[model samples]
Target chain A: MTDITALSEEQILEKLLGGNEIVFEQVFNKYHSSMQSVAYAIAGPIIADEVVQEAWVSALKALPKFEGRSSLKSWLIRIVANEAKTRRRKENRSVSLEAIQDSWSTDPRFSENSQWKNPSSQWHGDTPEELLSAEELKNCIEKSMLKLPENQLAALRLRDSGGLSMDELCNILEVSSSNVRVLLHRARDKVLKVIDHFQITGEC
Target chain B: MLPNCKQMAELASKNLDTPLTGMAWLKRKIHMLMCKHCSRYSDQIKLSSKTVSTLDLDLPINEDVKKNVEKTYQELHCRKDVSQ
Candidate 1:
């Protein structure tokens, strides 16, 4: 079996254009999740799969004209993001940034003077790998992530998992850079809190 | 002015996406030197961010959708070949 992961971008493009089924499957498996994440972030869960399917169709149709301007993964992600946005508009579902509450102002971790009222305790696991080793903690994190506000979840998914640039994130989420930062921060903070609680108590 | 603990927490999260620089960077460093709690908080957020990035959140693609996409690809490829 050829190592598709080892192939260069140009090589992958060639294989894809040549209609290599194996390469196509490999590529699909590699990016399908990230594409779905972007789609879910924009279009919501109900139509996210539909948006990704549409994105794949569009990407395949336009594959011949791919100029290699951005990475193949990035191009595909942008396609899904656009498809999800259009679908969202059609469904009359707007992801309102204003709906996100600014919890930082009233966070319980800090004191009235902005000092640490309840500081974080030492964790048994320091690295991400170590923390994720516990299956329950992983589930807890995922659950917390799913419960985050729509825009915040979208920002985190795009920036962290999708590996999109800040500019791309702003463009996709249709928010200012500062607003993107807030969304990203809130999402990450929730994850941090989840892990912290899990570490301290060993329960979800 | 030095950023308080709340501001430091925000900076730490922002630093993960875009590195803090100039005064912000210097201030975070200075504050970390004095406040162990904020330092730990920053480190924890960084760890969580790393974990989130590494998560495999991809739900499996439906088999029917997979087949349809493959079929569409083949039809497109044939059309291109005929045109060439």
Candidate 2:
């Protein structure tokens, strides 16, 4: 059994194609969660796993032609994203533009002037180490993240957590680069407000 | 002209993704130097975004799924190898 953790893209590709079960398993575990997130974003949670499964099959078939143009992870994620989009279209589920717009306008946090009506309070003990150490706060942040509007959550997940570039985000979400920037800003603002509220009141 | 606190906050959030450039960049720096609230908001939001990104929210892929994928891959590849 090969320890595929430290392998480069070229090496990993070679081992995976060489019928190494351990290498295959390691690769699957490494990316399944991120792919699941992309799938869920595009197709919703019910069929997210199905989309990921299909993506794996698609990637496996296309492996022989997998050019090293992009990192292996990026290539695989793009496949998952596209697969999920196809599934979403088939299911006839789409996020309405009106919903996204309404959420932005009716956001109670902002004033008519688009400034924070009740500006965010300073957070206490919010260092990265402190954040990780505060299990309750961590849980609070995660819950708030889940509650965010779908598009905002998806944008945040792909850019920040999935480590995708803005260009890739624009391509996946079918939006322009400036739109991607605004989406990310709005997403981060919502998350920050959650943290602020949590810090001030000790409630999520 | 320099941006106000409201606009400053938005710019600060945007700055996380892309740097402020040209005159707007200079203005933001000067404004943050003077406005304590916006400065704190800027710092806190950057920290908040970083912390939130580090949160483990990915949907779990359990052992069953992994095993299934592995088995499927092997079957597909093995068949292909034999055919070729």
Candidate 3:
């Protein structure tokens, strides 16, 4: 029904807890895409599928303990994040999220920067060939990213890719805020050099 | 207007997802209008962010995946918590 479609997630949660599997399915359908995106964003495409699966399991198990302490979606997402971490651990990898227990703290903007450009700044390169060629460029950069030290790779991915704040990066990576920023800047510098080399020399 | 350069940059990144506001945003906009190099840096940073965020990882969820996910969800009803 349109009314049910318009129901708040809270209402859905109530139905789910009331033992309505159909209502729970609704929640699953609603979040499935977003949940997968977040997991994939953190762990790459390979494990993201498994992560979401485990998250569903975990969410179902954790539901009884949720205690209505947060938004339904938020609680479910926390489980999703945990599942992503679990997948990372199983793979012996933690590229983007270092670990949630790190003591790093930061003021978000990082060390900060000056200036800005016109809002219209776009990354488009000239020529359809150039656009088509960017796939190669991304590969070149990805290869370079693999050469980075573990911490730097994690920091860069978390900051630039995950869009995590310094505080979040610190929490995820278990590092200091200052260290996170420093790691990010250094990693970025290296990536920039690699990208430049690829563009100029066309070599990986 | 906001506070410091670092704060502005941080806010700028955050604003990438949202909106700019307050004295800091206004001041940063002013600084941007006057500075080309910083603007370029910001743009580059943003572009790089997109590149890293999106990195060769996006794939459409084909029907097989949808079926597997649904099957998994159903099987979840068969077990208790194993997340410990």
Among these predictions, the greatest TM-score belongs to 1
For candidate 1, list the clashing residue pairs, or say none: none
Give the winner by DockQ: 2 or 3.
2
| Error at A30, model 3, angstroms | 1.7
For model 2, how does the per-residue alpha-carbon lDDT over B21-76 read when each residue is reduced to its tens digit? 99989999999898788888899878977886567564677666667778778976
lDDT (10s digit) by residue, model 1, range A1-204: 656889999999888888788888888888888788778878999888888899999999999999988888778888888888889889988878874566678889999999999888899887888888899999898888778887888888777776789998887777889988889988998998898898789998
Residue-level lDDT tens digits of model 2 in A80-157 = 887887888899987433334546556676678665577678666658668657677787777777777667777887
DockQ, every prediction: 0.60, 0.47, 0.19
First chain of candidate 1, TM-score: 0.86
- State the DockQ, from 0 to 1, for candidate 2: 0.47
By lDDT, the better pick of 2 and 3 is: 2
Q: What lDDT is reached at residue A70 by model 2?
A: 78
> Higher-DockQ candidate among 1 and 3?
1
**TM-score order of candidates, best first?**
1, 2, 3
lDDT by residue for model 1 (B1-84), tens? 999999999999899889988988998999999999989999988888888887756466778778888888888763454555
Q: TM-score for all predictions?
A: 0.88, 0.80, 0.49
